[model samples]
Target chain A: MQNNWEKLNQELFTSSKRVIILSHRSPDGDSVGSSFGLYHFLKKFNHHVQVITPDPVPPFIHWIPEFETAINYEKQKDESFDAIRAADIIFCLDFNTPSRMGNMEFAFDRRSKDAYVINIDHHQQPDNFAHFQISDTSASSTAQLIFDFIIKTKGKTALDAQIAQCLYAGILTDTGSFRFSSTSPHTHRVVADLLETGIDVNAIYQKIYDNYSQDRIKLLGFALKDKLKLYPEYHTAIIDLSEKELNSFQFQKGDTEGIVNFPLSISWVKMSVLLTQKDGIVKMSFRSKGNFSVNELARNHFNGGGHENASGGMSTLSMQETLKQLESILPDYKQKLDESKI
Target chain B: MQNNWEKLNQELFTSSKRVIILSHRSPDGDSVGSSFGLYHFLKKFNHHVQVITPDPVPPFIHWIPEFETAINYEKQKDESFDAIRAADIIFCLDFNTPSRMGNMEFAFDRRSKDAYVINIDHHQQPDNFAHFQISDTSASSTAQLIFDFIIKTKGKTALDAQIAQCLYAGILTDTGSFRFSSTSPHTHRVVADLLETGIDVNAIYQKIYDNYSQDRIKLLGFALKDKLKLYPEYHTAIIDLSEKELNSFQFQKGDTEGIVNFPLSISWVKMSVLLTQKDGIVKMSFRSKGNFSVNELARNHFNGGGHENASGGMSTLSMQETLKQLESILPDYKQKLDESKI
Candidate 1:
């Protein structure tokens, strides 16, 4: 499996002159980290490398080295499109499908005819968009895959503190700080190698987890106290937020990002769901422990699908109606939830 | 240093019959991790090893392997006393001074005449209590020292997953996940070695961080919203919680463990202070960024001292009076605080 990736990477880079790296929309730690990790690694070669994000990198991840250099397609459409047009090889990182690119999907599709597209991701069921596809669902994060890519192609000597810090942040956030089930011993070994590069793990943790606004934490408090709901019989928990409640806290794009996972902390909760009303649609996020399979639930009920333990969905109905839709279907999974307990 | 420690460890273990490991009162991650790491390492030899704590382990840290076996002096006094009395070798794992052992200090002192006490700690200015002292302030945690101790004596092949998990937890928590200044390149190297043991780093992190109660998070919200005070001129942030507020939240012993470190997340804040009134005395915690010395502030003004960035202090004055005291000294340290910023 690694030999194939190594051959493809070598063949693609040997003759390639200009390279543009792109991550999915609403760039997260993994997206930003993997893009920059590849960008920094490829910079050591005799080629020009550029990183472009679908949108601006979030403030929490702003401390990453050279993060400001990543061109935001949302803000600078002309420059991002120019880079996409002129690229010889384009690296699509962290996302599986072109539709996940949001507004950049058109540009990617238009330029794919001329550029050699390389899809590198950990998500399941990647689309057949790239000429060379390196996808592994078992990998903890895309950054981990990138680490293996670097080691396979350039060897361990190519790793430096800057690359290590970026990859570490990616793995740390995607594995939920090494707590997620996707994390394997190989993931830890990869992290160990990254640490050897003199990256400060704690500073990266602070930059990712602790750089939140005061109002966001306060919103978390309100969500837990006033919004959280528990269904012990079904081994499930839920937090539903209306547009007004979010506005009161002045909700930003990523304010409620990980709030859904908080309920999964309870010992008995096998599944959790978060429903937020925004932009005339009720956005839904589902998370589960063990083998409850939130992906199936999200796909069947709410027009979205992701990994087994975590998934996303959306509803065109009102917040009340969407919650009613959720309550209606939870009982069907009672047996599954009970069996998920280890 | 390695040779001396190896000799001391070999001499101490070879002739010893019963080994008892003791950590300081109000045991934390470092305390529990170091004690248990040593306990598991020594159990491999032809000797009986036991671990004891001055009080109950916090609920957040109770998921560690064999955690329930550690005798708590506060709850099981007779068993702890008997263990101390019968032991021929006592390992002082985390604390520097015997006074830090709380009520168990008497038993330690009484048994010191017959048993050989080996102190392995990573604190500044260790007391002259142990016959064989292995103290390095540069080490991230006592657990890190124990990792070195194992490598020095038995070689790296002797390390297993259980010991690695315990020591990794120790290093992870002590360095605040590797953000603290005490975290050096050597710390990362030690963690790398531990990770090579195939321990589940994510599971350990989940067990430690995601086990907090609902009230504790709510209390944090209240502390940030109602009690937090910012002195922008002095680059100081304070959280003053009265007894009533704590009672309303039904504060547990370790509820406020990391609350003081929250204000330091602000880009401009250089110093953070948490004052919580309990019984008659007001307990205080001081945290600073960069070169600011909280130890000096704690030692000179509040009758307490710890590491440079983190320190503890106490006051006999009323909560109102303590606020006045803090306010009065704000101007005196303006020059120092200004110069401390990196």
Candidate 2:
């Protein structure tokens, strides 16, 4: 018996049918785009494929075609859950831990006994539960890895506009439009490959980047005018968006996107904070420069920890409590900041 | 009688007891950063140097130390003008046209007859009026060229911390924090060189990108949420900010920066517009994708032009009139967009 991925990929053109894809909770661009991009590739083979996510995708990301057909597990209690049980192969994207899978963890666990699980992720320390574990930390996103996987598995040289569009979204959002440190030469080559498909790069860029609501713009204006706080001495800046203010702006789910970067502009300000309200809970995202260690801050102070420079934490406390907690630790990093002045 | 730039550069090093450096109108990152970077470099030689700009440098750009000393031409009147006239050398950076020199254009024209003028710019079609034109359009910004010029003139192999900070700003702003298409390998090498000087790249990124006013964020929110309009058939998206709304948000200058890309996220939208009110004039910036010609739109339609994909224009009409004009031409591009769909 050959490996599950090798056997499936080898015979995909012949008999592989009825595939289903699932991404981790809070499906980021990489997971969403990768799963959908693969869905598009499989569609050409006349395979019936459905993309499922535990929660609703971000509003700004509604532009993806795969998102239209995505099965909401919470909403479609019977169909989406039943569809997973019937699928031959379950492709899991961008998750290494079951806890990160949100509500789908139970369904995935139940389906593992019968269906094949093909794990594709870029995160560190993946669980040893999948039939096929193809993970690369050096890769910018799971979408990039999926692009290569599609090429190698199918042995196809042709890529259509839909395929190109999804791949572009995957590469773009993952790399922060290609400015993040993870962007490598291979990433550029992948982009070049996608571009060769004659998918309008500008169209893709515009659709994925430009659409915004007037209310969101108004909310950002309110934040900059009234909510931003700066600490020049400690080289720190914070922006607090109260729940009332968010509601007044007709707060859409994804309106807080890119709001955190604004506070990071003050001269000598190294640590920036964005505290926003979501469902009576405060979500604080910390962005830092140099050795400020945002992950450590989130881990020690809040109910979260992520990458070193960019990370997030959650708190049941009010916006004031979150700010108060952050300010308490400001003194600890002051001397380190002064010694490393550029 | 070597031409003025050679004469002035020589004098600036040899006999210059004092000097004041200034950039053109609407001082961008390259011009401001280059001027201040050079100011810091000359300070080590005990030369009295001040960085001046015709426009008020926005608070977001306060990271540069010399921003504190940038004398606004309008406020200083005769005193600062006299100092500039008395200087042995004037390094006019990043502006090839005289109009771009703003209120100080007349002063530069008058005093530069005797004083030396070294035109360091990255823009194409340099004005023949400059005595010394070390202009390279291929370079990312005038700051990178200035970095090269500094190494060549000073005969030094290494850049100091102040110089590194200044150079980094030029690179950061001009490249849209390294996300713009202009970022090249040479640009990366210059960044690496700056990093070698022990400048905190993270801190620089934080100050330039992460810092924001709550008002600005609120303004951005308003622009994206309410003002953005997308025309899918014509592959066009527009974010129109009126004077009334700007005032309502307590909008300061530089609030709409990077707000243009927000509306481009709608799939199939190839061209994006950012229209706003500035000094009672309506300004329009056009960004496009694929073969969409925003430069042509700006030139033939809006009395301005730029590169094929990214361009800008201006109009005296109110926001309503500008929309009417855009609607008139938008239908014409529909056919071309439809043809490119294949």
Candidate with maximal DockQ? 1
- Which ranges in model 1 have alpha carbons more than 4 Å from their true place? A1-16, A112-114, A266-268, B1-16, B74-82, B112-114, B181-199
Worst 10-residue lDDT window for candidate 2 chain A reads A1-10
Encode model 2's per-residue lDDT on A1-342: one tens digit a residue: 125665666545667577889888887777788988999988888788999988878765677775789987877757777888888878888888767877877777767356777888888877776777787888889988988888777654747768877877888898776656566556666776676665555445556565556566556656765677778788877888888889898887777888887666544667888999877799989887666678887898888899877899988987887789788888987887666433
- Note the residue pairs that clash in candidate 1: A178-B202, A179-B202, A202-B178, A202-B179
Once model 1 is optimally superposed onto the true structure by TM-score, how far is the C-alpha of residue A128 displaced, in angstroms? Answer: 3.6
**lDDT tens digits, residue span A28-112, model 1:** 9999899889888988886788898888788888888888788889999999898898888899999999999899987787784
DockQ score of each predicted structure, in the order shown: 0.32, 0.18
Deviation in Å, model 2, residue B96 alpha carbon: 10
RMSD of each: 3.2, 8.2
DockQ of structure 1: 0.32
Q: Write the per-residue lDDT of candidate 2 for residues B1-342, one digit (tens) a residue.
A: 134545655776775455667687777777888888888877777777766677677766787975777787767757668877787667778887777778887776667356666678888777865667777888778888888877877754546888888987987788665555555545656665676676655456556665556556667756655666767677777889888888887877787877876554444667889999877799998876567777887999899997777788999987889888988888877876666431
> Candidate 2, DockQ to 2 decimals?
0.18
